[model samples]
Target chain A: MPETFDSPPRFDTVLIANRGEIATRIQKACRELGLKTVVVYSEADRQAPYGKTADSALCIGPSSAAKSYLNKDALLLAARLTGAGAIHPGYGFLSENAAFADAVEKAGLAFIGPSASSIEAMGDKISAKRAMIAAGVPCVPGPDTALSDDPAAVERLALEIGYPVIIKAAGGGGGRGMRVVPEAGLLQEAVALTREEARQAFGSPSLYMEKFLQHPRHIEIQVLCDTHGNAVWLGHRDCSMQRRHQKVVEEAPAPGISPDVIRPVGRACVEACRQIGYQGVGTFEFLYEDGAFYFIEMNTRLQVEHPVTEMTSGIDIVQAQIKVAQGDPLELAQADVKCEGHAFECRINAENPDTFLPSAGVITSLALPEGMGIRVDTHIHAGYKVPPYYDSLIAKLIVHAPTRAEAMARMREALAGTRVDGISTNIPFLRALFEDSAFTRGETDIHYLEQWLKQRRAP
Target chain B: MSAIDFSDPATIAFLTEALTAAGASGLEISWPGGRLRIVIATGNEAGVDVSVTPRPAPTAQPLVVVKAPMAGHFYPGSPSRQAATDRLPSVLAADILGFLRVGPLLLPLCAGRAGILTKQLAEPDALVGFGDPLFEIEPQS
Candidate 1:
């Protein structure tokens, strides 16, 4: 199998097939590369700031995401109408969709991500675990195969993996379609419910069982690869500050973890990328528990938390992904890469702070901190209306400093300086979280945030 | 090849199923025998809203205007009806005035009501969105 393409990709204009901050982010990257940008928007996002800033923006469909962003034909037609040479599925939506990538390539347009085959391989959890194990990356204690229909066999496998096993849908991601069984008594019912839920949710009943680490922290290795088989693991991120499996805060260099400990795991991730013939940017998500890394899944797209790694590594990941899409070999080798400083990112969601219900309306007043190592990636401004039809993420607040404690202090200052009015934001919640002694100290597990919230709510 | 009898209820149901399977909003097939326009209003479900625009959203502009029923490339005149463009401002009959070239199929744009096409809002061969204003009509005095 060929790993590299010798010639440059024949494309001048890049179409961003996403909305909000990511779309704005992709446009900035394309502009830096001297490429024209075509942004497609749904009717709800007609007033979105990113659309106006792009070289060309077209309304593809109505307010619904189905009729617009997820509408493959509409997106393709929008690209054709605007004479776009390539499509960048920034994140979510069709970013991890294999068929969309294949269709874009088959339509003679470059898909600014990895190949469809790679996405397919990693999209399925069982196949991804197998690939990771083959590449010497650590995996959880379980078989790297789909569960069979035999109920007795399923129970035996659960017993083998031990109690408190997690049954995950092979096709599920973003923390959906899974159930944790505490003991053998509830195994069958858990499997049946998860199987039915998986079929209804991810359109696949195929599932895999694994030992559910009770207190594992979410660790991700950011990797960038090119068509020439060159790949580099930028650094590690500790996204342990999560609520309901949704990461609310992220930081680079992952607190007290030693380089000697993470270096091999990073290399393993890079090796997995090479084995899969991956191109563009991807994240190898893992669960860190008991001083070991367990491969969970690979996100074949630029992540929302990519900026923290960029700040630490002194690299422009979005631009690098775009250049790789242009058939450009990775300019920086593994040795050339250096991750310094510590960075933290807080997702500013447009939701009620206490209740966390989505609060979408016009931002009548707004204020954000601006200074050294303080960067805010947001599409909303004063008077910008937040739509109810999409993700609640309104902005990403990132800060960097020489040390983890300094970065925490900077984030504290950044959160204090940040303000949004006329609609609710999670700034209050984030401010409270930053003040928490355990999070400030770092190395908190994934379950820490929920526990803290529970403690706070307790009378 | 024999033209498909789209009027058949079984055929419509089958096509509807195919559309659902393909995750398409609707299907419009025109053959020598008949024409079928199936618009599936996927309500409260995970599907696109393929609501067939039977006519344009009438504006206060008392003049009846012609609008696109769906998305396609706008061509001012048809290959068989070249004289249609020349008859601008002419009291056209309830017939084909222009055509929306949707790939190989050219769906006819009907005046639906006899009126004078005062202005062509869209340029020839311009890729237009669904329900986009195509032609403005002025009723006869």
Candidate 2:
């Protein structure tokens, strides 16, 4: 048995400040750990099935997310009322909010995530890049500092980086607050426009520039750290299948890259996590191009695409995060970490396949596939009402196999067996993408999905 | 069981008051001695008149539900007055019905309309979220 730390703060109950499938997922993990769970819901989700299974459930507010899920005080109050010793922010909403994490800690309840300072450090794009560079991690060729006010210096910096460069806000992520200038002529104007937009949006006008990789793939490394300084990277995932800068599909082992090629980057990520004293689970997002990986940003919370990594590594990441929060040391070292099989996750969104418009209504009928190598994570069921106020993602369909090809085949079969009625979904589009020759061949960039959709629309 | 004395006016008046207090329209007690029927008038005119037949259902009085303005631990009344529920408090539109303790802040919950607070819907010291009903009031006729 691994040596245990002496008398760390242990929590017996956890309050999940999230909704939908993730809430159900966290409750399951808490139950397995012999911990009680308190599930909070908005009026829109009062009928959510997960609420019935929790140790206790509370209605935090009305249908608006701002008045409910995103309300920090409401979540804290709910935690206090339910006698929960910890709060689990399951991605999205307040998951990445540093102030919320700090407030949770201040309230004397474990935040079940990294320290607030760590979140702040990683939230800023420039500071995160600097930390990555300091840890000897590969990053895009650019100075690890924000752009100066002088237009001439900005122009010179862009020229030095190369013809095509991207100016990004220091406080931005999720593909927002960025402008790519292909040549020097548009550099100053792009910088000015982005600066103004950044000021209005992110509360800061600071900007940075980087050499743009025209055809880079979005790859991410999942890392788990404990309070005892031990950290390990589970594996890498390819999330290049996206639309409107939102990932739609993800697969683990990031096909075609060998362990030898990725091990160095993974090691650097672990080093970076230790350097910054990051705890719990985080994802190091990188852009891979021409056999080289460049660090982009790090998500300081569990990711929506975490299931792919979980399937490939055979690790329950949610449980691991909770254990780490309980002040447990790493049970396994980097050498013990193994990436076993390939896995793919398709985000089942409640939206029109053609127009991508959200479809929210009662699910009149439903059927999910269940067999070897197939898993469905969802809180939706027959007669479950899909609220129009939140995210469109209703479920995640994951499949795993010994090889990528087999995983793909299993996913196709699973998708075929799945059925949902009374609401439009992107299942048809996903089925078509699975049959695409290029996607089946395994390598596609972030822009491939949008281009593929456009081509399909052409007469 | 002994048969009820339906011929007694005292028994009939007692039954009429019971139906009025329970918010029911009418009640009929048929014993072997005789049948006793009572009906109450169905309007804002507040008096129970004993009659021999069922009258129309009572008109519903408008009610004002004092809801929580924010999420916090609910106190039925101020710290000095802890037994607010023991006696129904008559309140004006701006009367303080309770307080919502959120962290260091204590937000006052108003009655929002003039009425007799007929019920305390939320338990004292229970956590209440925004718009959760705390008190139900029947507006004065």
Query: Which candidate number has the best lDDT?
Result: 2
Q: What TM-score, over all chains together, does every model reach? A: 0.84, 0.85
Residues A305-385 of candidate 1 have per-residue lDDT tens digits of 999999999999999998898888899999998999999999999999888999989999999999998999989899999
Show model 2 residue runs off by greater than 4 Å: A1-8, B1-62, B72-91, B95-108, B116-118
DockQ of each: 0.16, 0.30
* Model 2 root-mean-square deviation: 13.6
lDDT for position A145 in model 2: 99
Per-residue alpha-carbon lDDT of candidate 2 for residues A302-351, written as tens digits (9 for 90 to 100): 99999999998889999999999999888899988888889999999999
The regions of model 1 sitting more than 4 angstroms off are A1-8, B1-127, B130-132, B135-141
C-alpha lDDT score of every prediction, in listed order? 0.88, 0.90
